[model samples]
Target: MKILVLAIDRDDDFGVKAGVKGPVIGRDSCLDAAVKLSLADPEDSDANTLFAAIKLYDELKKKGEFDEVEVALITGHPNVGVESDLRLSKQLDEVLKKFPADGVIPVTDGAEDEQIFPIITSKVPIISTRRVVVKQSPGIETTWYIIVRYLKEMMSDPEVSKVVLGIPGLIVLLYGIAKIISIKYPPSAQIVSSTVTGVVMLIVGGYFFSKGFRLKPITSLVRIVSRGLITFIGVVTGFIVMLGGAINVYLTLESIAENMIGGIPTSELIAFLIYLNAFNKYFILGLGIMISGKIIQEYLRRDPHIWYYIASFLMLPAFWKVIDLMTIYSNPLIKKSPETLIAGVLLVLIDLTLSIIISIKLREEVKKWSSASS
Candidate 1:
């Protein structure tokens, strides 16, 4: 369970300018050229760090030095604001501790020896890999150089780069399409489209993503199946929630009508009123809980936080509308649908509570699992 963590310095401003950061390579001409430089001669700081790690891993494997080794890319940063190396190192330390592998090695090219060495020494075995020989096969040396040079050229080319990079974007685009289609169709259609799109995405996107996570290659089948499962679960969950909500809404409207014609019960009416008045406040809190769980899940799922933030922000309006609807139905003063309000609140509360509990449980489970597996 010896693991090597390589943090490549792929910080190109194009990623920032293109508004695509975290685990994504940049798209600007300058950024592409920078990536090219890293690939070509290992001139860039980030590229050198990654190259050293890759080379060291290969060398160790060739020599049968680390037969039971696992390698991974490590990108550390703050959820908000710019993160420094110290903060990044702290996060890395925490990750390694949780994993508790035989040893932890960080491969950063230009990190200060003083700053990095102590941090590494404090944790586990630390190998700086400053002058590590990544490739030294006598016969393949020339071929390796030529290949690296060619790959650099390919990465620099707009068309090739687009093909290389656009796979994930395209997969995302197709997923969106499939989701949109599924929502408008039957269960069969939804399952079929989602399965097909998920498979296609896993194939296309997995290739690029694997390259991005070069050190640790995840199987294509695993990626595809996981995505399909998620899609299936999401569709099923949506259907269940919608059907239940509809039934509750109907019942609530009936009760509201009955109360209006008859008389409002004091206890039920008061509860309904309180819910309506605090709908926005409580629903927002509930949504926050739900989203926090989702974020944690995404992190565990290997998705970048930046992307998670963007996606969550985009869905906020829709979530708010749903909240508003539920609140309206539950409002005792505006409507006499106490039953409907109760049902909606209960549904949302249940979901929120479950997500939180599951998240906490998963965290503990993963820590234990990783430690045991390590």
Candidate 2:
């Protein structure tokens, strides 16, 4: 097996500190980088990660477990969040073009770099993952070093700073709102709770909006928006319908509970509410449709694995409704019906048949395509 030992530096911290940027290929290059990086910034975690990958490569070569073994290091932009991940993907693409490997073993020092697991696995199969850490002397001094390092990162990194600042900002805003409300009239619990909820929603909306703006992939919003329209529309439409249905259901239930609506049997009214609640099934249906659209999009891009995934996921709504209906009909505690039970069994058979067919077809397609590609 020809294997690659992959080291992730998602934010280029190691390269920036050690003055070694881009993909550092092979055992010698990576080992040299680890030494230089460790010397340049002895405290950098990426230095430790690099050393681990080099060590792993040496061990595998010495043990003669693999016919060929290589090592690589890839980094990304500092400030871009998902953009940095995309850049990392591009770098991996370049590495694959030059030096293809059967599988990769990703090595990371901490959570920050390890967060990009999907990016690495998407490009090549991962045999295993390794996380390296430099053992620290156990003392108050080590504790202080960890604290200062974390605080400095949180303060400097926008990703961490936003959450840290948002919490206190929310508290201050809610307190001010409560103080004003109290001056006019002593606020009730409802008022305080509503105020806090509204503030939280506002903050969450702002954060997502800012995050969306930061996704600078392709550097063109038009293309991204155009491609994402189906999902965007589906989600927005589903949310609108769900919101209206929830409000309508709540009022209807409240009226029934208070006996405000007359001339309707309570049992029938409750059953009717159950049927109305099922209207939210369209919300799930819309999501399934959006996912199907996404699968088609991926298919157009010629990703083989997505075909198998889509074949399974396309059954989402059917699987949901069939299982729900079957459970309702088969429960002996709730008046049993032979007719509904038989219907449920037939539906289950149909679902199983379709699933089996799709699975077989997917298996064939994957085998054929894998042979052609290889």
Top lDDT model: 2
Off by over 4 Å in 1: 8-43, 75-83, 93-99, 111-114, 131-374
* Model 1 C-alpha RMSD to native: 25.7
Query: What are the root-mean-square deviations of the candidates from the true structure over C-alphas?
Result: 25.7, 19.9
lDDT of 1 by residue, 1-374 (tens): 46554443323322333332333221232244345555554533444444455556567667776534544444433321245445446555655654555665655433222234555566677644443223333324335546766788778887676676666567677777777777777566758676877688677776668667773354654664475554334444545555555455445644654454344435666545433433444344445445555554555665533243434534555465466665555554554456765765666666556555655666566566657756
In angstroms, how far off is 201's CA in candidate 2?
21
Model 2 per-residue lDDT tens digits across residues 119-160: 878878999998776677323333554687799998999878
lDDT of the candidates, in the order given: 0.51, 0.72
In candidate 2, what residue range of length 10 has the lowest lDDT sum? Answer: 256-265
lDDT score, candidate 2, position 129? 91
**Model 2 error, position 287 (Å):** 47
How does model 1 fare in lDDT?
0.51
